[model samples]
Target: MSSLEIVKQYYTSFNQKNWNGMLALLHPEVRHEANQGDVRIGTGKFTEFLQKMDESYEETLTDMVFFTEPADSRVAVEFVVNGIYKKGEEGLPEAYGQTYVLPAAAFLELKEGKISRVTTYYNLPLWIELVSKPRND
Candidate 1:
């Protein structure tokens, strides 16, 4: 499969919350880096990370911006992830109710049809603002 195909497969499985499907596309030593303060490498760790992430989000990956440059062996995807938090915290207000959308971009490096490395960027500050408690001071 080509790099673009691999990326689409990743997102498609992600949207479905299919951990095994997503894992099938990753290299055994795949390294996943995110703006969310987690570093995960290796298939086992990566699977655990993904499971936790999927559990954290009330909404899933809904839309994707696609790239199809096969020569680069890389794929760049921009997407809007919409979800709700049943329980609120510092990054999300409790009384504000449970809906949030964070726009994100992820870049992936592929080798032999599997993801070797992935870097994800997103607006973490916005999430903080949405979830932050109002100060009494």
Candidate 2:
């Protein structure tokens, strides 16, 4: 599959909340550069991250626009995350099913048609601010 196709599938899996499908596109030694934490290597670590995220939040990517490098080995995607904070995470605001919308982007590197590295970026403070506000409902 083409690099763009692979990335499209990656996000499709993510939107579907299909953890195994997302993992299927990754290289065995895939490197994940998280937005606000240490780099995590391998699919195992990625699985743990996904599990934690699944426990704390429910998210879907929207307004997606994808860009690919001339070499076809690198892909970048810009999207908005529409999410609900379902459970509290350490060092973060308490969750009362708070909903938030945040813009985010991710850069991916592909090797042999598999995602070898993924680096994601998002505004943490903005998210915190959005979720911290008291909801009328």
Top candidate, metric TM-score: 2
Expressed as tens digits, the lDDT of each residue in 73-108 for candidate 2 is 999999999999999988999999999999999999
Q: Candidate 1: minimum summed lDDT over ten consecutive residues — where?
A: 88-97
Model 1 residue 78 CA deviation in Å: 0.3
Q: Give the clashing pairs for model 1.
A: 59-83, 91-131, 92-131, 93-131
Compute the lDDT for candidate 1.
0.78
Residue-level lDDT tens digits of model 1 in 1-137: 77888889888988887779989999999988988767888899987776665555566776788875748688889999787665444454553445678898898988877999988998888876665646444
Tell me the whole-model lDDT of each prediction, alpha carbons only. 0.78, 0.96
Query: What value does the lDDT take at residue 80 in candidate 1?
Result: 91
For each predicted model, how many residue pairs clash, with residues at least 3 apart or on different chains? 4, 0
lDDT of predicted model 2: 0.96
